[model samples]
Target: MDALKILIIPGSARDGSFNRRLAEFAARQARAAGQEATLLDLRALNLPLYDADLEALSGVPAGALRLQQAIQASDAVLLVTPEYNGFPTPLVINAFDWLSRIPATQEQPAGLAVTANKPAGLLSASPGAGGALRSMNFLRQYLQMAFAMVVVPQQFALGRAHEAFDATGALQDPRAVQSVETVLQSLARLAQALKTA
Candidate 1:
């Protein structure tokens, strides 16, 4: 089988965001497990909030369209979010709201699926002990609505995520890496099952 492609969407915008670092770690794990992974940073997209006024005047932004395309092509989605005041950041929500709009399809666009019925996984990391776990519940439900089968067997909730990774994105704590690897492994299998079954 061709390597399962996993797209990591980072919810935090900070350049040094722990959430983003956790995403990086996940991408690495996917590769180490003989799968392909890419980190799609929302900060680079700099999407404006989805609004009727902007859409009416400017139409869908090219960047947003490109992002939707990326999501459509990927085999699976992994949302890595940071809990801000016990919720995900605006950028994360913005990504979801923007991608939620299904582009017009005569009978679904060719080989690619525009975020519908794709397998998804949720991960959250925070400086707090709870590890942004609460954020994952909301995000999982949201992704499910987008038609992504959320992988739930090995959910990751890393407390003190800042200390979980190093400057090189290496997971510093053995326990933390094991926790995340469990999810990565499960996702790898599900991606294959969903592709074949």
Candidate 2:
């Protein structure tokens, strides 16, 4: 089978975001597992808040268009988000909201071109004990119900994220490393199955 093309997106744009480190680690794991992985930082996208009127006047932002194209090219996606008051970061919500507003074209169905039937995996990191698990749960449900994404059951939430990684961005906890590998493997299998189906 052809290698699964995976996209790893981190919700936070901060220079020292633990979620970004987690995304980088996941990308490396995916590559070592013989899958092709790309890291997409939300900061670089620089998307504005979602506004219907603005969208109507100016059309979809270039960032949303780029995100859609990235999703269309990938076989699977891994979303690493930082929890904000038990919810996903504003960047994530805004980006998805913009993507969901896109009208359908003859080539693609209406709305959610970025997520429809896409195989997705969720991961979150936080300094608190929750490890952003609530955000992960919310994203899993939202992505599955709202966008019809095929979200893998295998997910990871790294609690105490500030101390979870080493100097090289590698997870210090052996268990965390194992958990990430499991999620990647599950996502790869799901993506491959969908590709051959």
Candidate 3:
């Protein structure tokens, strides 16, 4: 198969966030599988809250524009989110809100340019046993509304995520690693098929 470009986005901005670790691990795994992976951290982006007034005055922020370009360029997206009281973190929601507002261009319709028809993999990690599963549900729904082609019925939710990794930030559980690999492989295959179609 052709080398796929995959974008890994982490939901949290905390310095020692488990979600960030999960995203990095996934990115490493993707590279090991012969795909090009780019990891994007929401905190570094420093995006403003979504507002119509701000957009009307200045258009999409530079950070959001950069993110939109990254999404458009990638063959697939993997979202590593954390649960905030049974919902996706604010950072993830804010970034998507900005990305969703990118105006329509000659190449594609409004919003669709960045996300429509693109293969997406959803994963979530939490310290608790539930593994941010609720957050994944919300994320899946949001991505669907954004017109993304979500790879369903195979999402990964890493329960007890705080203890799932080693000091080197490598995933310790073989099952979790295998699940992540399966999700990445599935995304690559689906993305390739869609690209050729």
Candidate 4:
């Protein structure tokens, strides 16, 4: 009877990224639904790009390991990404790569089992019209490789992200809010299904 733990991953490294704000909004919605939501800012993590040279010299960066630990602990993930060069930032992909390199662990006895039946909800945004759809497409595939149970039917690609939030960091779009709510609800149901099945 534990609360669901969801991690909000902001894809941008910008200090005031609108995508990050979107993640915040999603976290609030998930938390309001009786889940425990935490933010993991890519900018704040500041991890060195995944490097084979570094891995050979040092096992895994403490920061990287810390992120992996968090990934291990969480019950689900929410990715809020922005379209960059028609895709998400390299930082977000790097975060995934680093987490994947943790070696097949008991927490992950197998790739699928390692996640402990965690789920993921994807969201994307952009100032440009298409709304980061291409970037989200790539992220969706990446979730599969991580063995995450992705929530469908609520995929959100919020457009004109800058206009979607206020100075106080509140979400302004009712559609975007509703989309986030739907995704969170689906995530909850997916988690429940994974636990039982």
Best by lDDT: 2
lDDT of 3 by residue, 7-91 (tens): 9999987889999899999999899989999998777877999999999999888787778878888999999999999999999
- The candidate maximizing TM-score is 2
Query: Any idea how many clashes model 2 has?
Result: 0
Runs of candidate 2 exceeding 4 Å displacement = 106-111
Worst 10 residues of 2 by lDDT: 106-115
RMSD of each: 2.5, 1.3, 1.7, 2.4
How would the candidate models be sorted by TM-score, starting from the highest? Answer: 2, 3, 1, 4
TM-score of each prediction: 0.90, 0.96, 0.93, 0.88
Question: Which parts of model 3 have CA positions greater than 4 angstroms off?
Answer: 105-109
**Clash number for every model?**
0, 0, 0, 1
- How do the residues 136-162 of candidate 2 rate in per-residue lDDT, one tens digit apiece? 999998899988999999999999999
Query: Looking at model 1, how many pairs of residues clash?
Result: 0
Expressed as tens digits, the lDDT of each residue in 1-197 for candidate 1 is: 68899988888868788888888888888899888898897867767888978877876666666678777777888888977777778888876676555366684452224666677787888989999988888777766665455555578888987677776888888888887888877777777887898
* TM-score-superior candidate, 1 or 2: 2
lDDT of 1: 0.77
The per-model lDDT (C-alpha) reads: 0.77, 0.90, 0.86, 0.76
Model 4 per-residue lDDT tens digits across residues 48-91 = 89898988888666666667767767877778898778877898
